[model samples]
Target: MCSNGWIRAHATYYGVNDSPASLGGACGYDNPYHAGFGAHTAALSGALFRNGESCGGCYQVRCDYWADPKWCLRGAAVTVTATNFCPSNNNGGWCNLPRHHFDMSMPAFFRIARRGNEGIVPVFYRRVGCKRRGGVRFTMRGQGNFNMVILSNVGGSGAVKAGAVRGSRGKTWRQMTRNWGANWQSSGDLRGQRLSFRVTLLDRKTMTFLNVVPSSWWFGQTFSGRGQFL
Candidate 1:
């Protein structure tokens, strides 16, 4: 962290300006808009991605106008959701380890920098609370004894640290392991049962979404909870 809470970093942009091409990413938010992230999203470097644990996290980023006045838009900042990863490149890319960087969507980058900044700019960023429109959502996938759920629309700390699932027929909650990105998996056969979820956020607050998934739920269906992290 920088002295004043902001951390020094570099930023670049990818995909078309505000287009759907920027939607899906490594975080499994195939359609960020549908996942409640909108187009204001970014791909974090390995230093920040934390092996996908940083997915759904929010950050406030602004170009360092004082450091690069010619390319930065003074006082302009944008809050973006972490939805992708900026992999390390053998050619010593900006996203390489030890170098904090943000691969932002085109629209997000342009918000804080001049259009012709050559795709990169000095930046300062800080984690911020995610202001989602609703309670946390769970998108269900997989079949039979294998269950995969993707958590989204998270608020507060935003990123989920851990999760557990309990079916109506089960007396105890079973821990769900991280499958990939924001997807959590469980080998329990939870078919034809109402599902409750207990999610722990990075802040250590656990919110239990009781019976968030109905017994009639099907694959590829998303269920919304009634509670959200503060």
Candidate 2:
């Protein structure tokens, strides 16, 4: 890590300018546009992905103009959300293990580097708080006794550490386990009851979204909470 809190890393671009490829990613945010991340997103390397734990995290990245003036746009930077993973390649890839890399979307890359230099550019990145417009969202999935909640539009730390769910008929909250990426799963049958969710961030701050999901909610529907983390 750099003395200024920024860590030295490298960045590259993928997909076209704000294409569909940058939408649904490993983070389970089917459409980043509706998920509140927009097109400013990136696929993190293994070093930073932390086995999907780093999903929904935010980072501010800037090109190191001093290192490569030709490709790096002077004093240019962009903030992006972690939405996907860049798997390591055996053929000596930049996203290989032990190396921190950000495979940014083309639009996000153009904000910190000139066009045509889509390969790799030295950069400095630092974790930052995510600023979301609305409250946290939970997209309901699965059926019957199995329920998966995909958390999104989270603010503050932007990464969930733990989650719990409670039906209107029950006073106890069922602990949710990490299924994949930002998705948390609960095996309890919650059908025909209003749903409430409690989310805990890495900072240990917890928030309870009371009755965010109505009793009529379906598998493919999404519900928004009334509050957000600061």
Candidate 3:
């Protein structure tokens, strides 16, 4: 377990009582509800946030004792997904912590920390392969002549660094712009054509899916790709 990459940090929570739409942060995720939960999501500070590049990345965190010796998890750890950013302005300067800090959800923090300890706990964390249940999903979100696609449920590296699209009859791959979050947009019309995508993970790994979107595909539709980044 110590062989993988890891970081030391402090943990905290947000949206503990009610879920906010912005829980998806700047990633434009279609599943804000899950992002709002403490069990599966976390917020990273500016350093670890990687300018949103860490979106969808997964990590396993174990609490380290700093204050009261009475509350300690010993070595318990919990896994969480990168779903939001923890701005430096929050809560007295904890978020302003070094690049290694993490502001986790209550459920995630509780899972590693003892029953109570002023809500702040030191932790040892490391990036881990995201465990997705099925194939990756591409959700279409544009008008008739334009295309804005959101990539989600990606396994492994999680966030996408670059992406391209090609029409059923086209030979060249058209680059897509990272509009925000996981949403990528094409500059031209892609109507009447089945669509394929090529994605580059943050780690520089690449994957291409042919005809993942059928010619009959419409705006707001979602299609499942047969493969995922390992």
Candidate 4:
């Protein structure tokens, strides 16, 4: 991290690999290689440092995720990182899951995930982890009840739709396109369908879009999705 003036660097310079097999003899220029390329980014980076192994000499501090009220309306872009909890099912991890594509004429929707319980009152925001029918239920914990909700299919047109919230008392409210919640689940069925959607704060007032689904994401066994913050 950097402040008015700050600096950082290598964990320990194992120095350089001088082994003959390591990009050696000035004849392997065509073949570029990195150690443990197969390991997770975190694991791979950590792999190189052993015994006195260090993650990154001058590392950065970070949070898994967070939300900012200022981000909601300050032209901040909301990004949704989708991760299917169960990979055996059709859902893929964030990087692999299909970006819910939709036609301009077709209505878009939101999928909030809340996997815990802590009596969370629903307001609207870039991300919400509410329960849903397409899959498992939403999770809640302290003020985080409504933290991970995300909007989908939002575009150049600034239009908003309000539909009755669906799901159990503590579940995500499914806002339909025409105030009709009945047809919510039975809508068009497409693995690659793109829907028109946008991210809004809990009040359903302040809103923005989480850019687009990322082509790739840092992963763990139980990663989550919805519009993400900076």
Candidate 5:
């Protein structure tokens, strides 16, 4: 668990019939299923969601009890990645209910609960290091000389605190501005050369990925590197 310790929250799932299951949520991820993304994704409430900046953050959740004690998982827990927003004012929404809440994926919710009790379950959860299969992923956006990059597939202190970029032909590294959520923007044009990026995790540790973006990279394309904060 993260330094925040175990927090009480309500846990629910979005089954195949839900929008998040059929179509991706607000985070822009297309495939979030367990077979696709390993059933490790979740939608967090506004209290802990941090807008979209919480994307990639990980949490460890345990089903302590449901309507009946038999439905509990006996403390077995599952780690889920933050990938969408759970709004607060949508009638049944609990995103802003003065406490942290997690609307987990169906597979993730079941991982910590007994069968047939998949509805609302009482949970104890906390922030934790994200264990991911690959290194970090960088998605390119924007056009011309400007660059807007979205960082994902992050592990460990899952959220990025800062980032920098350098062009293959440029002599110095340039810092990127946080546009919103996991997206960052570089001030100058990097269209003519391959780009290298330096990322800093929320834990204050930093890493440099050299030449991760090819010179011929196009807008809306994504590239993966071989390093992570974990």
Candidate 6:
């Protein structure tokens, strides 16, 4: 403990899968996972605010909503949630409830050949329009800096938006993040090739963002990669 009486803690955690079933009591326990990597660091420690658990709000008292054009009001000084893990109507209660989108697809034959064959691997980006459902959590790690994650999108003109998703608020602790991204990971049958994208909500001050979903092409192209599209 420091002279100020603030106690510090450190620990390590392992095991690949960190699911809600595993972390039940903790706040924002479901869909617990690491950003890109770091099984131990993610479980070690950081800052934890449960789903719907908030200290008043991320804002002070009087602030403007700059994250969205619809969010207009000089209400409370809260962090205009560009991304939210709390069980909130992120789109403001039905006004906006759409999954993060990324549009990209290849013929089923080509998709299979790409993942299964591996010889002709096609690498591209798909923009993640938004988060899937509320509780679209974020698992962050590291202390010295923010955990980096890239959100690749496939644009019409064939452009890739490269960026990283980070958890900056929780930096002091060794590493900790407890968010539940329930609807973020879902796969089912589609009409044609599932061309989708993954959006990584990043700090513009540090990272970038992208979109996913449109024709739903790459949804089933590869269970290995697409499975973790969340």
TM-score, cand. 6: 0.22
Off by over 4 Å in 3: 1-4, 19-22, 32-38, 66-68, 97-99
The Cα error of candidate 4 at residue 49, in Å, is 48
Candidate 2 lDDT over 1-230, as tens digits, reads 88789999999888775443376667778977888988899999999999888889899999999999999999888999999888897214888989999988888999999877747899999999999999999999987889999999999999899999999999999999999988899987899999999999988989999999999999989899999999
| lDDT string, candidate 5, 99-209, tens digits | 578888777878988778647788888889877677788889888877898788887878888899999988898999887666789988788689899999888889999
Q: Each prediction's Cα RMSD?
A: 1.9, 1.7, 2.9, 22.6, 2.9, 23.4
lDDT of each: 0.90, 0.90, 0.76, 0.20, 0.77, 0.21
TM-score result, candidate 2: 0.96
Determine which window of 10 residues in candidate 2 has minimal summed lDDT.
16-25
Model 6 misplaced stretches (Cα beyond 4 Å): 1-8, 12-41, 44-179, 182-190, 198-200, 204-230
Model 5 alpha-carbon miss at residue 91, Å: 6.6
lDDT of 6 at 151: 22
TM-score of each: 0.95, 0.96, 0.87, 0.16, 0.87, 0.22
Displacement of residue 146 (Cα, Å) in model 6 is 33
| Candidate 2 Cα misplacement greater than 4 A, ranges | 17-21, 90-92
> What does the lDDT read for residue 189 in candidate 2?
88
Per residue, candidate 4 scores C-alpha lDDT tens digits across 12-123 of 0011243221231111111112211111111111121221111111112111123322211222221221111111111122112232111000000111212231211111
Ranking by TM-score: 2, 1, 5, 3, 6, 4
lDDT of 2: 0.90
Question: On residues 73-185, what C-alpha lDDT tens digit does candidate 3 reach at each position?
Answer: 87678988887777786655877846466777777777777764676767778888777766678888888667899888888788789999999878999999888767899
lDDT winner, 2 or 6: 2
Backbone clash numbers for all candidates listed:
0, 0, 1, 38, 2, 42
Q: For candidate 5, which ten residues in a row score worst on lDDT?
A: 28-37
Quality of model 3 by C-alpha lDDT: 0.76
Q: In model 1, which regions exceed 4 Å deviation?
A: 17-21, 90-92
